[model samples]
Target: MTYFRSMLPMTSEEMVFEAVRKCLDDAGLDAGDVDAVVCGSAPDAFDGYHHKGLVAVEPSGAFAKPFSRVFVGGGTGVGVTISGWWHIASGLFDKVLVVAWEKMSHPYPHAQPLFRSIFEPILEQPLGPNLIWIFALEMRRYMERHRLDKELIARVAVKNKANAMDHPYAQLGAKITVDDVLKSPVLVWPVHRLDISPTSDGAVALLFASEHEAKKITDTPVWVDGVGACLDSQYWTNRDLSYPYYVYLAAQQAYKMAGITNPLKEIDVFEPYDPFTYKELHHLDALLGKPGLAPQLLKEGQLERDGDHPTSPSGGLLGVGNPIAAAGLMKVAELYWQLSGRAGKRQVPNAYVGVAQAWGDLMQVGQVVVCRA
Candidate 1:
């Protein structure tokens, strides 16, 4: 994976090549060994290009091979891996290369304006709504429903950013205080600047192999135990913003497939997407199969790297950076590293099972992947 940053001095193809090359090199395999490829990216406008799949083919090592692109807003990262899982799971491919990249830096001024296109043109676009304003509404509802204090939510940013201090690819790692988060500029009520992750440019790649080939690739192959995805009502107004039922449904589907009835105890590590401070808590609660339970766990420091049931030890999108799809794929990569004992300084002790989740598309889509050592 490439380092998460605001402006990478490389083209989109260069970024993809670096990540896919590193992944293939690590796996000790060549592009010829891969039977198929999947490219995960979001919005052509963000990169100022169309037919992004075609642009990604060569750099992703998909020349003359089965290749496809996936876009599920922020969920594209994990979505691509899921796509690869099925490629091998369905007995259609032996080895699959999954690549996720985003270049938000190419857009002039800022990439935030591009999100305006995501909303319903006739209904929502007239209001000129952006992610921040909509997220503010969700944050407010979550806080009120849980009766959570701003300080509690601020601790997420504090914990994730501090955890990122050990991550080499992290962009915003720092030892900050809750007061620092509270003092930052508030773009919308209940949503501080520090609470939001930065727009970034980066890429991440992963290789999926069948059990037969995986055993040959590496004895310590991290198994993709379970995968699940769900999309809620597209109109954000139709659902209860206080909680994410879509995430819960997706987690349930994954947990059942993984034979995990008790997530808090069975899952050792978690890497839920955290584009915003509250989102980590929001998704965590849903992933745990217990709504409104994450706050207590957070207060007790269970979400810390050294704590029981450690979460986002990779610093998550909040600290590591949010390159849209790449950030989500980064979570899955973090799970592979953690479960395989390759996470180095950020390793969670005794971690055998881990869950990585990402939410996208009008706060409606939820994608989850579970891995085990």
Candidate 2:
């Protein structure tokens, strides 16, 4: 995976090739060994090009191979890995290459403005609602519902950025305190500059192999125990912003497939998408099927790298950088590294089972993957 950064010198195709090449090398294989390829990118608007997926075909090493791309806004990252999982599961391919890349820096002025197009033209667009504004509303709802202090919520950024200190790919890793977060410039009410992840340019690639081929590749292959994805109503106004019901539904599906009856006890590590600070706690609750539990976990320091249930040990989008599709996949990559005992300094001890989730699309889409080693 390419390092998450505000800007990379390479083009989108080069980034794709670089990640795919590294993935192949790590697996002791070559592009010819991959029977199929699946690519994920958030939007053509971010790349400033049409058919962004097709443009990545050659660089993704999909020439004359079964190839396709998947997009679900920010969910595209983990969504692509799920797509690759099925390609091998369906008995169609033994080896599959999954590539997720985003170049949010290409959008003029800022990538945040590109989000305006995601809203409905007739109703939502008139109000000029972007992701931050909508998320600010969601954050306020969560805070008010649970009566959570802004300082308590700020700990998410503090913990994640500090955790990123050991991450080589992290973009915003720092040793920040909650006081530092509360003092940062406020972009929207309750949403400080430190609360949001920086827009970035990066790519992440993963190789999926069938049980038969996986044994040949590595003795410590991380298995995809289950995968789930769900999309709620497009009209974001109709849903309860205080909690994410969609994420719970998606997590239930994945846990059930993995025979996980008790997630809080069975899952050793978590990598929930954290484009915003509160989202880490929010999604953690959904993943655990216990609303209001995440904030408490944070307060208790159970979400830290050395805590009982380590979360976002890769720094997450908050500190590592938000490269859309790549950030989500990076979570899955973190799981693979952690479970395989290869996470280096950020490694979670005895991390046998891990869950990674990503949300997007009008704040209603949820994508989840469960991995075991």
Candidate 3:
């Protein structure tokens, strides 16, 4: 694994092209076989580029293909994935290439200011708030409401970074204990620097084929069982930050589509967004339909890679790295790998139904996809 910050002068164009090329090669297809391309990217502010879709063409090798872009902040990756599914599921194309990328390091000073800018200028911006403040507020809210101790939350940080130890592409795997996380400097009250994932420059791509084509391509194709995305009203003030209401709504839609009545029993694994330590628990509580469930699950070791309710077996954004849109795709890709039994060391036992999710945009949006193998 490499330091994410020390990487990526390669530009997203090259990243997109290479990732798509790898996807095609793995699928045993050529560029000519791709009927269309769907791209997902973060704000042009992160990569410092305008017209991201058009700019990505040359390197994406979609020159003569129908090229399109879907921008959904951090949810861009899975967002484009659902879009590509539409292309094929709509019977408009047999194969659609889905790609997502982010170069957060391109922003001067850091992506932190860019994250702050996501706040409404009139109401929130004038307060001179940094992103950590909101996270702290959310963390404090979740903690105060549940009387959750810091050590219990620190376990997520320890577990996820340990899980990343097995991911070949991971950036922040360590053997730290809960005490270590507790000892790390606090960036904000109840929000330690160790609790946060590093902003990175990365890209990921996948090929979505029509069911008919997928059947012919591989005997062990991972089926897209369901997908759901939702957004909440702006401002954390509008809703309770402890529970991700939008995340629950999106997961419910996905579970219904997948015919899952009991998520804990029906779903084999979880890959929720984890840009922060508390977020993993925050999103899971909503996803599980029980508030304060995540802390118990984490303490019971149910979230370990080989545990009963495995979560973030790919190290999640915290361990593997967070490149905005690319991070979401990584979660989706991790599901594919776990389902197909291609995940090397991080693979779970007899994994079948799993969910991948990403949450961002005013801290209100949630994107989810269910996969079965």
Pairs with backbone N, CA or C atoms under 3 Å apart (clashes), candidate 3:
none
RMSD to native, candidate 1 = 0.8
Given candidate 3, what's the lDDT at residue 225?
A: 86
Give the poorly placed runs of model 2, Cα more than 4 Å off. none
Higher-scoring candidate on lDDT, 2 or 3 = 2
TM-score of each: 0.99, 0.99, 0.97
TM-score of candidate 2 on Cα atoms, chains taken together? 0.99
lDDT of 1 at 242: 83
Q: Which segments of model 1 are wrong by more than 4 Å?
A: none
| Tens-digit per-residue lDDT, 20-104, candidate 2 | 9999999999988899999999989999999889978999889998899999989998999899999999998999999999998
The residue pairs that clash in candidate 1, if any, are: none
